[model samples]
Target: MLVYVVATALAVLFTYISVVYDKTLKDSLQKSRYVYLKPRIDVWQKLTLYVLRVASVLPLVLVAGFRYKVGTDWGNYLRSFRSVTHGKDGHYGEKGYRFIQKFVAFFTSNYIWLFLLCAIIFAGFYFVGIYKMSINPPLSVALIVATSIYFSFLNGMRQGLAQAILFFSLRYVFKRDWKRFLIFVLLASSFHKSSLVFLIVYILYGFKIDIKRIIFYIVIFGMVGLAGGQLVKYVVMKTKYAHYYMSAFADGGFEWLWFFISTAILVVMCCYYENGQKSELKGQFNVLLWMQMISVIFCLISATVPESNRIVWMFNIGQILSLPILISLEKDKRWRLVLLVLILGFYMLATYIAIRGGSHRVLPYRMSFGGE
Candidate 1:
């Protein structure tokens, strides 16, 4: 109940702020539009558009509030604490995250209290993304968070506050500030080591893609596959419940293929767009697209070839940035609505199938939100 209240309050506050702030910002855009080739959209019309954008954020809150998936994430959260606290600097040595779990455990070892706290933490992350967007079109941030598997998996992913921090880092990256990106990535690594991979983004986003860099990326991918076996072995032995490694990710074969297809499409979007259009969207798409592409490539080729589906979570790295890029670029309203429905439906179906596959699995405490 407290979770619902907090989520509701944040949603209302974000929507109100976005609507109120846009008048000044849109005036600049309207001036540019007139200076360019187009007639200015009137102030009244722009304000109405602002209201609609603000209004759009509400549904996401409603949906996430209605069916917050609180399963496996909760378990991961407890283990995160155990990894950091119970043993010798174990979290760092383990190569996986155990930091936030330890922090939460400090307050109350009780699972119920821990869950409410986690929900609050994730909601805070969700809003931070919205707050960052208040300077521009804010609906984009809210919509992306609302539709993301990242948001859905907050229970598991919330172990160390990576999503919240990552969103803030993304805000910086969108602004073209490499320094802030470095700072956020460093901070994120303190919580989860896997986040270190995010720092490599400059290698992709920093320089113009030369033929050599492409070759380097290819070589890196191959090395990841070759090194994957040793790395997985190390994490499994060092980390708790490591045997969960043997269970194959259910989305391995065909579902796995779709991931590559998604990456290919985004790359094509980059290539097909004019240099100016690409420049406009690059603010959001460049880092995210490469991150998802690299993440999928790594998961697909790992030579150890054990049942290491955990790597798939890396794909959600693209969701926050990609949604807004697609929304902002898509010119046709009907087509935009179609894509929105398709994206939402795809996640709904995918999530339902995944949860159903694990239906027989039992939780220590079933705080159901009708996801069964």
Candidate 2:
């Protein structure tokens, strides 16, 4: 536990330093300097930025990937990997995940490699998205840690992979590049079929809808939630993924209430910014707003549908970017600082509960490098 906390603190510190370097680079670019010295300084800053980015993600990848009996699914994944026959037709997981398992099994037959590869894929995409889309990268990174979403990824490997893929694809969604967006979403779906649900985002990207109308949609979704379990059962029964839902998993119930509260806060923040600040990123705010609404609906639906938290996360992951982006919109430095402190405080408390809550089963961290 101490190691985990220390590693996370180090990553957050390094990431903050990287953001400071970014500001320095911009400020330096406006200064007049000797041509030779300027280029050298620019190159050095860029290299430092790259290294810091790697440092920011390294702890998370190592901690998650090198785990032994940490995540709830660790044993299940290990057993599946060992039992899988190479070069055989099987529907063990989504095609992308199955291919990864097969590739790992064919060479070293080590489950460690499987975890490592998935960790790399997830961290690589997730960090890249945070760096590109977030206006406040440090805050975003901290939020991700505090939310325990990174730990969640260790357990839900397939869905994590898909979510990371979708994270990258969001840029195309914002750009309205339908072809690229569709391609990436399809790729993500190959990792987890539920990722296909993200395709609806393309239509919602730039569509103008008032908040009242959005509320109406939420009401309709709440009604659907009343029968969500039966609805899910009916659909799963006709799909190959039925086995996963065959046994009734425990209802998430109020487990997802925090997401709803966070989403509401984000919505309010974005609306405040949109109405007052008048930034150019208003379109991006709208996109995030719609995504938050969708996430809220999914959260409600998951209340009745067993194991639907997996689906809820697909939309909820938007918070990683949404919250940081909203915070960045504040022009007053003092207010920004206050918001950051409050959000961080809340996140710290939430993370403490999540880790101790045991639903994620990530406590008592173990490593595979040494004897298990």
Candidate 3:
């Protein structure tokens, strides 16, 4: 528990420092005396910014990379890594993940290399994703920790990689780069077939949410949810995800916690609605709104078709990303601070519950190579 606490604190602190550095550098460079030296100063600023950003992400990468028997699937992943290293057909994970396992095994039979590489991939994509798409990157990074999404990366390695890739692909979605977006979706799907669901975002990205459309989506998805279990069973049976049908996930149940959290964020956004907001801000908010709505739909489906909850994660980025945008839109400074504290406090409490729950088995953090 102390391990997680310290890692979270360090990640948040370093991220805050990076944010401060950016602001301070920008302000300092705007002076008339710095005009002649702008080129040199700009180069230095870019280098320093890169370093700070890397520092902000290093704690998370190190903690995740150095773990041993930590994540719930630690043993399972090790078996698969060893199988690949021995020139056997890896049977545990997605083909893309297996391919990477084989590629790594070609160089070293040690499984720690695979773990470290996966940690780097997860951290790199997450940091770069939030950095590119988030208005408040620090808040977004903190939310990732406080909401226990970071732990998910430690457990669901392949799905985590897919999610991170899809998260980064959002920038292309906002830019309306169809070719790039499709490419990324295909890339993510190679790691986890569930990520293919993200392709719908491309088509629905332009939706301007209104009461009528909201009601329509609710009705449509609600009906789908009613038949969710059977529907998912049939669809997954046709794909590599067929095994989920026999797993604990097939017993459908609503994710009340996720429902509440996602709905709360959407409601908060609606409460703080501003018609006079900047076009760029509005655009970003609108895209995230659709992402949030997708989360809501899957949450509804998961109630009766629990396996669909996996799909929920692919779209849940909006739940965290939307909060900072709302905060930025707030006119009252004190109220803004209040909102920030409430959201952060709520998620921090969530982190305690999630860690204590032990679903991911990430506590009692132990290092690899048989160290405590």
Top model by lDDT, which number?
Answer: 3
lDDT of 2 by residue, 1-372 (tens): 676788788778888888888778776765635443453355667898899889988888888888889877777777677776444543457888888888887787667788888988998988888878887777777777776677778777888889899988988887889999999999999988889999988888768757667778877986787566687778877886676565546434655546656565656764665543377777777777777787677667665666667766787677787777677777799988887777777777777877788856888888886222
lDDT of each: 0.51, 0.76, 0.78
Total residue pair clashes for candidate 2: 0
RMSD of 2: 2.8
Q: TM-score rank, highest first?
A: 3, 2, 1
- Model 2 CA lDDT for position 187: 92
Q: Kindly indicate the candidate among 1 and 2 with the higher lDDT.
A: 2
> How high is each candidate's TM-score?
0.62, 0.89, 0.91
Q: What CA root-mean-square deviation does each model show from the true structure?
A: 7.9, 2.8, 2.4
Candidate 1 error regions (>4 Å): 1-69, 73-111, 133-155, 158-160, 176-179, 209-261, 264-268, 275-279, 302-312, 359-372
What is the alpha-carbon RMSD of candidate 1 to the true structure?
7.9
Judging by TM-score against the true structure, name the best candidate: 3
Instruction: Give one digit per residue, the lDDT tens place, for model 3 in 1-372.
Output: 788778777887888888888878767767644676543356777898899898889888888888998888888888988888778988877788988898888998888888888888988988888887788888898887776778887888988889888888888888889999899888888889888888888777676677446658767977876766576667768986677777876676677877777778766766655541354677767777777777787788785664676777778765556778888887799999999998888777766876787857888788875212
Winner on lDDT (2 vs 3): 3
Candidate 1 Cα deviation (angstroms), residue 68: 12
